[model samples]
Target: MSSATIRCYIGIGSNLDVPLEQVKQALLELRELPESTLIQHSSLYLSAPVGPQDQPDFVNAVAEINTHLEAHALLDELQALEQRHRRVRVQHWGPRTLDLDLLIYGNESIQTERLQVPHPFMTERNFVVYPLAEIAPDFIFPDKTPLSDYLANCPMGKLKQIQI
Candidate 1:
């Protein structure tokens, strides 16, 4: 793992097993990650499911962290957290007990078999983009485009912020 610290944004969501509590617990777990410091987190929001309509609505939030772990290692830790929550991958964009996505990793653009920085679908997902903009309003994409640019095209849809 690189000794250099990188700021990362993690997108959190859950629609099963008491989603509100699951997301809350995930934020707490993020604070305890080895070699990482939780910087700030966005307010939780409720949004309609992105894929199948048969599932429950999701509770979402974004967290900022500074970490000494390499990108893949960070990914490993995030997945481990998911496993601890009993996350299952039975369908695409399916209901999950917990969903933790590495939305951004500093300014680096990473692409490998196991991970992709600046999560490919982030810009199009209001749940990801809105919560991200909440915590990092001035954040620019690794490609140099301002986040506000995406906000213009991505409608808020049914997303609603919830008081925790």
Candidate 2:
């Protein structure tokens, strides 16, 4: 963790073990992360599963936070949250009790064995893009493209906003 606060974005999703409840509970926990403050969160959106269609659709949202934790430390906190929610990774993009992805860490572009800031698939997934754009419309990617540009490419035809 660092002494300086850093603004970060996180992608959240769940489709098992009462998906909506999982998201809601995770949000509550997120607000209490050590050295972190959850600034804002986007409305939950229902989206089709990215992998096997045999599972339930996902409930997704993005959260913005200010934290003293560095990128990797933030990721550790997110994973711990997921574990608390009983998340299990049996398959890629599979159904879970909760999933937390560190989408961006300030202006950093990180690629380590354990984490990747500016999540690799955020721009391509409406689930990630729409919520992110909703809260941080002015955010620019590490590539310098505005967040709206990615949102434009993401079609929300199948993504439905969950009435909170």
Candidate 3:
């Protein structure tokens, strides 16, 4: 019997050098991952940097994908992509050439030494929720709350759609 497809949401962002170009490139790269297909993507948004706010504003988006890989393997692929984009690990939430986060993984809850599923902070970031809602308006939180309801109550920042 064929295994059911896993639905995943990924958060992408860039704030160093050519931010838009990096986002575009990251999307294309995501489309190329093995055993995976890019399903939907939200428009890009420009947002003030979170965490350490000493750097440039970020260009962010969320993408929905269908994949066959298990969670940690997917995380490995994301990290490999980050290395390709020259992502630096020197600072928390620092400037980056590309940032790809596996925000949700088929309702699975994972806690590991190097990874976390259902991303610990997805709900609090417009960079994540807005794009997610654009694609899957009815997505449910780990707590079983409707995403649309959360979006309705969220004070997320303005997000602009940029054509790829």
Candidate 4:
């Protein structure tokens, strides 16, 4: 684990088993992560499933945190939280009880067998980008692109913010 704390953003989504409550619970759990503090989070948003529309709509949000844990350790913690929520991976872009994606890690770009920071597809997904823009409107990607750039090109489509 790194002693230095870094600001990070996590994308949260769920389309199964009371998705609204699932996202809310995950936000609370994010606050409890070891070596990390949840700084802020975006309002819950409702969005259509990214793939396989046969599933239910998803509830999504973005969380900002400062963490002393290195990127992979933080990823571990997020995955553990998902397991506690009973997330399963049986199909590609399948419905899940909870989905936690590490969107950015302090302006660092990371790519490895197990993790990717500034998640590759975030720029193309309104469910991820819109909620993220809500919490960190001025954020810049590791690649030096402004969040606004993606916002300008990514249509909201069916995304809608909902009060929980």
Candidate 5:
């Protein structure tokens, strides 16, 4: 592995098949990823389904990692981990066993056919903002704004911190 390591943040969420356990297991698996050092994780938060409200609420959290792997490689690894837990992408923002999102990779703005760094909605949603800010309060957005500001602006409706 290279000596270089970028600070990366990932969003983890689950609402099906023992959702709380799924997030916890994913956190442990994240620490075991090759060539990566698990930094820390935020406390889990419960949030209403962002899309269709018919499904169970989601348990969400964020993780910080120091990794030698490039952005896309890391994304692939996350997806593989989700697949290991039997994640099913049946509908847009639908319920799932696990959902992992690459939020930021050391200030790099990445756009590809499969991934988007900064996570597109990281700045707006309470589920993303609260947990991410909890882990990386000083993290800056692509547009040169601090994460805490976004977390503060997010509406605190259905998001509640929960131990999982």
Candidate 6:
């Protein structure tokens, strides 16, 4: 039997000093994950912080990666990369030099103390939905809803797509 390929989406953001540069580096590192291929990247976007409004807004975007690794293994690799980049999870929605969140893993729905698939607020956050739609316009949620349709009804954030 051939190995199964899993498609995973990653939401990347940075809000502290030199965020753009940090985000760029993070993307390069993500491309290095084993058994993975960086499929496509959404244009970079700048958006206001989600919760606890005191922090700086983040530079956000989404990327689609094809991997042979299982969902939990991908999560572990992402967390390892975050730690390597000095991501400190001290507070909820805190500012960071880089944040990498696993947004989706194939059609898998996972819930555990450490992770959740399709993310918890993917449809609600323009930062996540917009960029994800940019790269994977036809991607469907577990509920069989098209991403573009979901984005049409979500609250819009201040989004600026950076020209590469």
User: Across residues 1-164, which tens digit of lDDT does each residue of candidate 3 receive?
Assistant: 11668999999999997999899899999999888999978888888898997898889999999999888888899999999998888898889999999999898888998788888888888778888898898898777989988688767766566666
**What are the per-residue Cα lDDT tens digits for candidate 5 across 1-164?**
44688998899999999889999999999999988999999999999998899999999999999999988888889999999999888999899999999989887898888988878987888988888877777888777988777877888897999954
Structure candidate 4, residue pairs in collision: none
Query: Using Cα atoms with residue i matched to residue i, what is each candidate's TM-score against the true structure?
Result: 0.98, 0.97, 0.93, 0.98, 0.95, 0.94
The residue pairs in collision within model 6 are none
Q: Residue pairs in steric clash, candidate 2?
A: none
RMSD of each: 0.6, 0.8, 1.9, 0.7, 1.3, 1.8
lDDT of 1 by residue, 73-143 (tens): 99999999999999999999999999999999999999999888889999999998999999999999999
At residue 140, candidate 6 shows an lDDT of: 88
Q: Estimate the overall C-alpha local distance difference test score of candidate 6.
A: 0.86
lDDT of each residue in 1-164, candidate 2, tens digit only:
79888999999999998899999999999999999999999999999999799999999999999999988888888999999988889999788999999999988899899987788888999999999989988998878999888877778879999998
TM for candidate 2 is 0.97
Evaluation by lDDT, superior candidate among 1 and 4: 1
lDDT of each: 0.96, 0.91, 0.87, 0.94, 0.89, 0.86
Better of 3 and 5 by TM-score: 5
Clashes of each: 0, 0, 0, 0, 0, 0
Better lDDT candidate (1, 2): 1
